[model samples]
Target: MNISEQQIWDLTNQAIDKLGANASPDMIRDYVEKEIANRHGGSLPTEKFEGRVIITAFGINKPGIVAKITGSLAEMEIDLQDISQKIMQNFFTLIMIVDITSSPRNLKEVQEELARVGKELTIKIYAQHEDIFQYMFRI
Candidate 1:
């Protein structure tokens, strides 16, 4: 039968206590480590993002629109991972993937600032985390 990691840890600790070997804390830890290493050679790395944001903006095509949004991101030291912008028949559309790992401002502040810029530029802007985007668009 397959046992969970927690179960293995609990059983190890209980056995140690019952045996009363006067084992040192380090020894116990090493034993557990060796046992886990033997059971599982190496654990796989998890997929994680420090911070990710998907932003979409649409409006009547005009100049300096992309500049305004990108300027805010640059000011906050946010990394622009990916971006796409197009203008067709005077309608502007832009989508961006932003990394906020080293940004000085939080997500809320960035959203608010983008909203303010959108109002000034007469465009609509929306931001959502990558995970939320995935969930909403999941099959």
Candidate 2:
């Protein structure tokens, strides 16, 4: 049975509502899987789901920061799933969710590249697999 994107979204929304602010990534994932199994009378679909990475950077505000970072990701064929950034005065913080399944480089390579870029720009950047990130930051 094929599940539409809308179905996934609805399931995700329901999970969020049920779990509220205490929900971790693993919790949501498990909730969705259980819901799908209950509704479809089987396990999740056979489609492969690639792991994602979380990228975070922060430093004094400067021009071309986003451009440079995104450009490097593009060069490595990384797909940006979502991004949020905020700048206050001279400081800025950026967070991004990226899919590196298409990239020729692995997570460590990506982190090294981003670290180099951050050093060049005098900022701080960190990358972690979503699972590790979620585990480390669980509420």
TM-score of each: 0.61, 0.61
Candidate 1 on 56-132: residue-level lDDT in tens?
99999989998999998899889999999888899999999999878767788888999999999999999888998
Tell me the lDDT of candidate 1: 0.83
**RMSD in Å for model 1:** 10.5
Clash-forming residue pairs, model 1: none
Cα lDDT tens digits, model 2, 93-135, are 9999999988877777888999999999999999977898678
Colliding pairs, model 2: none
Task: For each candidate in the order shown, give its overall lDDT on alpha carbons.
Answer: 0.83, 0.89
Question: Which candidate gets the maximum lDDT versus the true structure?
Answer: 2
Q: Give Cα distance to truth, residue 21, candidate 1, Å.
A: 51
